[model samples]
Target: MFKFRKKKNKNKDSQALGGLDFLSIFMRTLKLLSDFIYVVIILVMMLGAGLGLGYLASQIDSVKVPSKETLVKQVSSVTLVSQMTYADGSLISDVDTDLLRTPVESSAISQNIKNAIISTEDENFESHDGVVPKAVFRALLTSVGGVGETSGGSTLTQQLLKQQILGDDPTFKRKAKEIIYALALERYMSKDEILTAYLNVSPFGRNNKGQNIAGVEEAAQGIFGVSAKDLTIPQAAFIAGLPQSPIVYSPYNSDGSLKDADDLSYGVSRQKDVLYNMYRSGYISKEEYENYKAYDITQDFLSSGVAETTSHDYLYYSVFDEAKDLMYDYLIKRDGVSDQDLKNDETKQAYQDLAEEALKTGGYTVKTTINSTVYNAMQTAAATYGSLLDDSTGEVQMGNVLMDNSTGAILGFVGGRDYNENQNNHAFNSYRSPGSSIKPILAYSVAIDQGLMGSASILSNYPTTFSSGEKIMHDTSEGTAMITLQEALNSSWNIPAYWTYQKLLSEGVDVESYMSKMGYLIDNYNIESLPLGGGIDVSVFQQTNAYQTLANGGVYNEGYMVDSIVDSDGTVIYQHEANPVRVYSAATASIMEELLRGVIKSGTTTSFKSVLTGLNSTLGNADWVGKTGTSNNYVDSWLVVSTPNVTLGSWAGHDDSSAMSTSSGTNNNKYIANLVNMIYQAAPEVIGTSDKFTLDSSVIKSDVLVSTGLKPATVSINGSNVSVSGTTTTSYWAKNGAGNTVYKFAIGGSDSDYQDAWQKILSGK
Candidate 1:
């Protein structure tokens, strides 16, 4: 019994010791954990601090910080209003409203506006050194946790930085950059200066009038019909709240109409929030806050009917596009921007964005080649006569482009039947087959320029088939006989054009080289119908520019709308430089010009000749040259007319490529002719330079057999040589005796069949 009791007692003692040891170990572990918690907190703080410092130091040297002087200058200056005007200084439009958004000074703004904006946008604007670190920490936690967006903790200064410099990307990296820039900005600008710049640069969305209103001053004026200086407390609260969600709180729709009463709840709700913030900031008392919050802010909004749609919508696009092109050229030529970047679409887009931004905001003064007088007259004439053919089932549309041949500048254009009905710039924006009009340029010019044929060379007008079994048809049934080149062109016959093109192909002529120099790109090569406009196409502007080269004495200049652009600093950034390319010899152009004269004189454009007969009394019978084109099945109609000084190209068709009736095409032609008649009536000086065709001394203008393209061959009628005169015609020939070697091919004769043709010329057959 004693042994058992002693053992039990020892066991109890051992158990008690073990329990004490367990408690001691637990106590040590508890104390160590307590100490490690502090260490962990310290390590986290050190890591965050190290990362923040490293990021700040990394961007510090690279980030450009504005000096106080530069900040003040930026705050004081306003963007210049962009203007586009006629060469005569006639106003086209106040292109933009940079002048209307006049910046209000600190003294000019109301205290209530400052208070409302400060309380709502940044509660501690007056106290912080551009950042609120605690809010930033909360934002970082929220962002890292992915629990919310990254906009939770930006100070007013940081918001300004985001608006002006750092973009508002919802990322921790952007936030860090924003914090850095915000801190730097505070050092270079005062509190009021920062606020002023913010107010001036911030977008305030559209007003009740539905015009894009920006800046605090414009917001106040546009939303409440009150200036920023005169804004009441309610108006101030409303305007101050707009920067948070401008479009959502806007009182108007895109069409300048007032929003629905229910739809306006957002702006009203936002205004109440602004008033509450003001009350919390002690800027307004409870009584004042309630009074202004209950005051109907919508009652102050401007109320009017929807704004009327404006005209000349296409002109703006034309001017802006041409101006951007000129700017791109200037950037490449003057600023030495790398042209290799323009080859890549993405990098080229970057360069384009840069140039476009400058044009939109750089306060550029753009001068255009659009002659207001001539443009207005053409517009009026087109509208009047074009309506004669406009019908319900098929709405006829017309596009006319007039170019100054001397300068290669577009003088005027008739864009469409009505801009509201159709905004497509048919003259410049769309391309269509020019039909037989392609003959004179692609076929005849190649033949003449290559010394293949004279203007009066006889060609077989019989029908031919392509190798692909496509039949070439003629507009009239009289095309089965042999005819001179001038007759074939004037008659708008396709068989003759095909024969000529075949001859050109057989002779190894580089027709595309000639076409390219005239800016006519051959999209379809080796097509037999190319000479008849079956394979190639062009816009009225392009066709006119190409033909203008012929009128410009073989010199080609790319047509441009922008004349001279003066930057806001009064520096001429662009001056229209004539980069003339010689596409053909002056003698060749002269011969082609004379050959084309028959088109208007006695061919398809005979109606235009009647109009010219009237205008000739003023310019001492000014001669006009022109050509007409009709796409297959009358899908498109074209008429191009020119004097030595200017060329006007016209096209008429449906946007959907639907064919019109023959009468409709004729009426379109008549409308185009009338447009030219009115232009000549309005601006006769467009052709005041020269009406007579020119031929260089290197070319001989002589009489030749229309059948043989050679001066009547001498015959042995007597001892003296007698000239055979079966059928004689006048044409320009190379003085070096380079006659058309392909004349035999035109008459369905190859180079081996030359003896039969010479025998006929010798016998006067």
Candidate 2:
């Protein structure tokens, strides 16, 4: 309703004014036209290039494609076993020279896996005639944009043709030839035949130690330690996801352990993507997809046949398994032997066969971290102790791993009593419950690292209930009310450990993740098993490496057996190089070591002192530390011993988790002690039985009241103040113990009252 006079100006406002700027509009129009012309030019260029490539492909003489019968026949020929050697370049005798392939029928592979592949790689695999036009256009656009070759576009039939008849030349001519051959093959073969061949021939991945893993059968064995028919949804998803990029998604790295965190996360993400694709394609229900989506792929991972006790010497199995995987990866991935080349008539050898030929015929050398003298000692110890415990029942089996504390090098390994009697190598691949031995590494050390307590901090050692209303009590405490961290660990008391874990949990710490930081795989830290070291599984290798972390002042160095590998032509193919990762402070590690020494001095492991004395006088006086763990029903007994230079983790149990005879006069801990003593005696230079831990400067040694965990305090009693002082109670703390406390008490004036009061105060009654 309000009217205003318009002010006149030479400058125009595009929004305020009715008409737009003529020059600006003209420039924008020109820009849009130019952009259109630029796109047109790009299209013209791409079309010309594509037309030229097509013309040249038509002009080229047609190469002879293999017949269907010949293709199928070639798939099963001469899959060879890789060769293995000792560190000294000597060939391991009686090695299984036959090829390693346990082929599974095509129908046996899980439908989830098939659907996963179809969804991820080629969604139109069932309907397309070897290739999809839309996918081809997308790929062509991506390539023309200089984004490199995209993965999708080729149907399963086309992939089969590319793998079988047409080689991987990565040229325009090869691409054209593949298309032609794929079309022809599709006409010759049924859709089911193409899919089956593709599934069988696809390279899923290689395992750790360099073994060539091909086909669904080998892939299933390599990744899950199961046959193809037994593959679960998660396992199948992992395998089906690998053909896109074997090295990138493989659960095991080149060294035969789980991949690093980034790669592992990426691999898991890819698997989930495949699962989601299956879900979108209606191959799985929403509930099934959701359930499987929560599964962690690493939970079921086993590199090749590690879980299988193959018909080979168990002594060399650990390193041999790793070396084989490395050798195969090197031959194909590094040395440039394609799967097609492996299947070619000219090569006459699969990648594994080639690796074997290189070792056997080409004179390649395999090197490892095994210390020969220590290895022999461990072997002898196992045989002697095993025979003593055999009792003709053949139930007792022992596994041990001796590792260098400083270097993380595996010095010696024992799989079982005898390879001929039992094929399962409990040391390398098998997982067992660790029992109370895990206190220092899992619960107590983690608590120490988090600044919750020091060696002398007192924890209520009585039966206590957790937030979940679950109670934990120690068998060794016998109604004791309080104990220092050192005493609890030395005595293997469960209540103190569980209380410490609860403290950590209350502070929002994920104990399972904390244990993983020490290099063990765990899903969740259950309250019931955490303090007692039950409900968790670990291999001897993993357990020993964990103890090595304690001995190395909390620095975790991954344990590796192989040192270096040389090809037949004297080229260094692979090298073992590990950098120590510090997981806890030096003070924490030193405190843990000192506490473990208590186990040797007066706790569960004290019985081995005489055994140490009998082995060598130096060992008796050595500053050694150890812990003993006995599982439920005495099913598993463990003794992990460590000196400055060496650490040995030994497990004695029945293969089927049956009880060992406590009354049979065979003590597993004594046997382990004997083994440790022999290993030290055999390799005194490497082990140094008298070597002692060098405590960090931050690890301040202080005298404290054993019960109260404070600087030895004076108690007012019987009209006189008695000073409670002793050299026996020592504690290691970070810097000066500033925030620590000591319990104060008062007593009545009587001889009996004084005695009773002193007893209550001293004994934490």
Listing every candidate in turn, what is its Cα RMSD in Å to the true structure after a full C-alpha superposition?
A: 15.7, 19.3
Cα lDDT tens digits for candidate 1, 1-765: 000011212112111112224445445334433643332222234246555433322322223444555544543455556778776767676464422355777877888888988999888888776777666666666755777666557788888766544344342334444654565556567788888877776777786667766677888887787888899998888888888888888888876688898878998899899999999999989999888878988888888445444455667778887888877677555423354535656545655665665576567889988888898888889777887556444778888898999889998988888787788988889989998777778887767777767776777765556778766677546346557778877888887788778888888988888888767778776987888887787999999988898888778898988889998778899889989998877877888888788877784644656644554455425667778888877888888877888998988888999887876556765676667667867876765535676666667666776666666555553255555556666768543443432334344533434445555555766
Q: Estimated TM-score per prediction?
A: 0.73, 0.58
Highest TM-score among the candidates is held by which one?
1
User: How much is the lDDT of residue 693 in candidate 2?
Assistant: 83
Cα error, candidate 2, residue 39 (Å): 25
Candidate 1 local lDDT, residue 102: 54
C-alpha lDDT values of all predictions: 0.70, 0.66
